[model samples]
Target: MTEMTYRQALHDTLREELLRDENVMLIGEEIGIFDGSYKITAGLLKEFGARRVRDAPISEEGFTGAAMLGLRPVVEIMTINFSLLALDQIVNHAAKIHGMFGGQLGVPMVIRTPGGGGQQLGASHSQNIELYYAFVPGMKVVAPSTPADAKALLMASIRDDDPVLFLENLALYNTKGDVPDHVEPAEIGKAKVTRTGKDLTLIGYSRMALVAQQVADRLAESEGLDIEVVDLRSLRPLDRDTVIESVKKTNAAVVLEDDWLTYGIGAEVAASISDGAFDYLDAPVRRVAMAEVPLPYAKPLETAALPSIDDVVNAVHETLDAVGRRR
Candidate 1:
């Protein structure tokens, strides 16, 4: 095992995939020359040349539409917000091609973009709009919270025969974790059990998954609460069974999400728990989500708008209280 930051893991995995498959190519603005906005594709241009690490104009729709046609293209939109420009191509053409054509053709492409607030990029740039792509039927969405899963999931996304929306959290770029020296591609639709506890189930994905673990550990130390954490690795083909099973065991749940509460991923999760494990639930599922307004540019306001560890902790406490479990 090798400990590395999430950025390094993603870079290494992209490099490894490029070497392993000749068909795998990266296409995006500034990816080749400027080395990407977050530097995830740094130095790849010199290593692979212009043909493989191709750079396009700053046009999301044009590049996205072009990249989807052929090759196993990893199209990196500057941010998830910019992805909106290519929504028509992504939702109408890329996503529906396989199903619309009777499975004769498939878009083996990957749209990799970073989202979420932290650097004060303001409301327009720092939005966590993953729910948009994950809502589409033909798109496969994967968000990895740890460096290890980042590598594994990226490898899997690159190799898959479907169009994948690879969600990266800006806050997690520097986070460090152990990654296997020899890793296998993670099963795309699976959820991971990061921690086990009997008191309540804490579920999240992407950045919030890391937050869930933090809350679990903090509560374990302070309140002696056994909190089980379920990380939803894939959002579209959400592993509802894993979530339901965890909630069934714990009999209570608190969902943490970086997106807004209205029709957010957490809402889907809470509904899943209600549908699958209604009889097992000891209390109504609680959801902790970002403030409904657009994320603020000011650091303090942005911090206040986004969901924090305190929000999750408080939700857990309230859920436990409702269940008659005083922690």
Candidate 2:
């Protein structure tokens, strides 16, 4: 295994895929000359040349549409905030083409973008709006919290026949972890249990998944509570079974998200637990999420609006206490 940053893992996956498949190409604004907004495509243009590393105008809709028809194009939307510009194409065409046209053709494309607050990019540029795509039916959504998962999931997404929205977290770019020399593609709709505990289950995806791990560690040290963490790697084909099984074992749950609370991904998880494990639940499912407002531009406000380790820890305590399960 080799240790690398989250950004490096993604860059390596793209380079490997491009070399492995003749049809695999990359498209997006400034991806060629500029490398990329976050440098995930750095040095790729020189190796692949202009034909495969073509740059598009500042038209998300136009380029995204072109990618849909192209041969296994991996398009970068710069950031999730900018993906709004291509929502019409993403929701209308790329997602619905296969089902709409009676399976004659499929949009085998990968849209890579980063989201989450903390860089002070302001309300417009910093937001965890992946729920928009996750809510849609046709597209598949996957968010990787670690370098290893990022590499594996990217490989899987590129090879899949359906369109995939690869969600990256801005805060995770510099984070480093050990990744295998040779990795297999991760199954898209599965959730991973990062820790084992019996007190309560802490469930999250993307950045929150990492945060859940941190919370679990702290609870283990401070409160002597065993906290289990489940990482929902794929959001669209959410592994409801994994989540339900974990909650059943723990008898309590706390859902964490980087997005706002209302109608957020946590809501779906909470409902699933209620439907599948209602009788076994010892307490109502709890959720910790970003404040329901445009993420602020100021550092203090942005931090305040986003969910933190403290928020998650507190939620776990409250959930446990609600059912007198706290020791």
Candidate 3:
């Protein structure tokens, strides 16, 4: 019932989960005395002691693989760009250890990292690696868009049996929203519709959902389009049912995404709509996404690459116009 920043909610969840489970331990850069780069683990070291809240050196691959040897390590990279350093451990060991060893052991680990662009942190640190991780087997990918989702999903990931890639956007750290103390464990592969409507469905992930919500409000006021907005907090094993059901009722859809359009999660959602909800479709599904270029460093070029609220509005209008033309 209290409001908290997404970062605070995450920190609270980590502390609570640690209190609930002794097997859980965290290892990452600056997570201990420094309280994490984003302060998500602030004050945790004081509460749990140094053994639990470890500060690994800059070697992500070494510490990540070593942590997976036994303890249920929660490896939090300061940024997702640094995750590439541990890709071998992630792709080879964490992802394949149990399967390769014929179920002798399971890597009960959680890899947390920050992603996405908007803070002008430049192009190097802003890539959304969800689509890449979704390609690998034996790994679960999650992205929480709200304070509630951030807390609940991270708690669930901590208790999960397999290795999980939990990605938080750098841009969402300061975003404030309501979260309850008595939160339940959220299922990892599910989706939630933040706002319901009958005209059209707007699917978005992470920060893009906020963008779509803004566009949804404008569409209702200006264009009379009662658009439904779906917040897909989980990326891998996605909650396809929520999206399919919304599109069935609305008869049209527009996907808003911040990643490059090619092979992005939005493309997967669009394909599923065409395959599963083809009969209910009134118009071709459209997506508003980043352009296919290495994210630019300059402000103007970066702004042009990313989708905006206006882009979502235009996509909705285009879908409706095409639907009308069919008659």
By summed lDDT, which 10 consecutive residues of candidate 3 come out lowest? 63-72
Q: State the lDDT of candidate 1 residue by residue for 142-215, as single tens digits.
A: 99999999999999999999999999999999999999899999999999999999999999999999999999
Candidate 1 weakest lDDT stretch, 10 residues: 62-71
| Alpha-carbon RMSD to native, per candidate | 0.9, 0.9, 1.8
* Candidate 1 local distance difference test against the native: 0.93
Clashing pairs in 3: none
Superposed Cα RMSD, model 2: 0.9
Candidate 1 error regions (>4 Å): 67-70
Tell me which residue pairs clash in candidate 1: none
Candidate 2 least-lDDT 10 residues: 61-70
TM-score of each: 0.98, 0.98, 0.96
lDDT of the candidates, in the order given: 0.93, 0.93, 0.87
